[model samples]
Target: MHDTSLYSSILGLSSQWHIANAVLDSKARSLRLDIAARSCAEFCCPVCGGAAVRVGADKGCWQHEDLLNMRFHISAVIPVTLCKTCGTNRISVPWERAGSCFRCMDNP
Candidate 1:
């Protein structure tokens, strides 16, 4: 397994998620990971907690604490799901909180 695979586990991502790429900018002192959901993955309605189908996706970037003195960032393709009851909503990533641009390491 490559080091990027280790990031998936470290980030608490499930099998449904995949790390598409990883970039390290030594000069910039930043580490970025690009993540996406598996094609067969399904999401729940953020509002109603019901099954939803992916309608679209948007690019999102989030900042995380520095790793080994390098700035860490997470760039993802965020899926937008269409729920019968709630219309369309952006699915939350496992490492982030709803409506937040930062990662949550512990329950708050």
Candidate 2:
């Protein structure tokens, strides 16, 4: 597949999965990266659909490949929210699934 096709597929998959903005930046040391963020309001308890309050943040990073054989790093600030009604903590991510390595999945 062509580079554009590959990128398009990844973007499509991400959007289908409700993934947030997938930024492509070269300024940082990493060649390519996908960043995701979530807020307290986004958190929804698995047991209930109630909104959860911000409890804390979890910092994480993931590596992926770009269109031109460039390496991309995905950094995320995951939010942990506490549901008052359920008394449970909810984890929310602004991007798609964590383990999805688009670069690896898309072969040209």
Candidate 3:
């Protein structure tokens, strides 16, 4: 059966985001999910204490743990911000480490 909630729960994803789509490659035995944020303006800038706007996203991907023989990955264009003081900046994802390209647990 097709299910995003199961994977979402496994990922411990925050309520602010949801899986937009899931791509399965049976031949490669892999799965990739595209996620989207519910809101963007709720967050503040890390560089400066300034109000920020959600500019868009920076498409990035992260490899995650496997489910049996199938590899799982999460991909998204990370939401960006246009801070009044910091100019333009990419907002951090909750699942990723500070300044790291991949997730906190995943090896890059």
Candidate 4:
């Protein structure tokens, strides 16, 4: 997990999410972090709060505050969950609000 935990903590992530991989493009001046859910983790339906199983994932990218004067991008495999009662739903990422593609930044 080498330095990944550091990035996770910087990103304000919890146990459910972790940094799977990362790339720093100094030439392009950007940092991209790939995020994934814990494999053995169980998810609940956002609508019904019932137990849900991961069916698949959707690739998504969102811009975060710049890091070291370079663009910071958070890329994640957003989980698609199957709930018996609610059918299918896309689980929300901790960094972003539902249906948005931008990470929420702290106000100071």
Candidate 5:
């Protein structure tokens, strides 16, 4: 059985951002998600609060937890926006903590 709480949490987190969709693939054991927002003008720099330009593209993968003791992997095709003013590359996502998985309850 799937845990509704987990699904709700994922949906809530995605809602906080400009996410297009979030999917949990049990067969692939991965959460495939994407974010939808303006290409350059409206997007904000993830590192610094500055205007960003679409410089390149990248993907990130992390390990999370599912219902019960099952472990799930999450992959996001995040855009690599470069801040011309700050000269910093930014990726947008609701990351709970640095180097911490979303599903992990342990404090690092």
Candidate 6:
């Protein structure tokens, strides 16, 4: 079993989300963390305060700080929601900005 807490802390992730899996390749010297949402029912529209429905996911990876001297990538199937008022919108992530390739969890 892998240490979820370690990755969680490394990524500064909330308990609401957890690392679904992590792939480590010695030859490639890379670590990829697959993140999954704990619950979609609690998600709300960014523009409106109304409940949203999951339409699909946007699969992408964000470059992360080096871990154990290996290049790290934090990947996720970020939920795309259909808001009653906004039509369709991407869910805001906690680790990165609304639209960015870099993780801004520790950044001000």
Candidate lDDT (C-alpha), each = 0.79, 0.49, 0.72, 0.78, 0.54, 0.73
In candidate 1, which residue pairs get closer than 3 Å at backbone N, Cα or C atoms, i.e. clash? Answer: none
- C-alpha positional error of residue 1 in candidate 2 after TM-score superposition, expressed in Å: 29
**Which window of ten consecutive residues has the lowest lDDT sum in model 1?**
99-108
lDDT of 3 by residue, 5-108 (tens): 97777666777678889988899999988887775335567578588888777777787555656877788767788898888888777657554333533335
Among these predicted structures, which one has the highest TM-score? 1
Query: Comparing 3 and 5 by TM-score, which wins?
Result: 3
Best by lDDT: 1
In model 3, pairs of residues that clash are none
lDDT of 5 at 61: 58
lDDT of 6 at 75: 76
Q: Give model 2's TM-score versus the native structure.
A: 0.47
Candidate 5 residue spans exceeding 4 A from truth: 1-8, 11-41, 65-68, 96-99, 102-108
1-108 per-residue lDDT for model 5 (tens digits) = 333445446545443344445666667666644544334435568777777777776666555665335465444555677787677574655654555456422323
Name the TM-score of candidate 1.
0.79
Query: Which is the better candidate, 1 or 2, if ranked by TM-score?
Result: 1
Q: Cα deviation of 42 in candidate 4 (Å)?
A: 0.9
Those runs of model 6 whose alpha carbons end farther than 4 Å from true positions after fitting are 25-29, 39-41, 65-69, 98-108
Every model: Cα RMSD to truth: 4.9, 8.1, 4.2, 5.2, 6.2, 5.0
Task: Please tell me which model should have the higher lDDT, number 3 or number 6.
Answer: 6
The sequence of per-residue lDDT tens digits that candidate 2 reaches over residues 1-108 is 113335445544333122344454456534443334323245566457787666776666655654355666545555666787877553643334565554332223
lDDT of 3: 0.72
Candidates in order, TM-scores: namely 0.79, 0.47, 0.68, 0.76, 0.53, 0.70
- Displacement of residue 48 (Cα, Å) in model 6 is 3.0
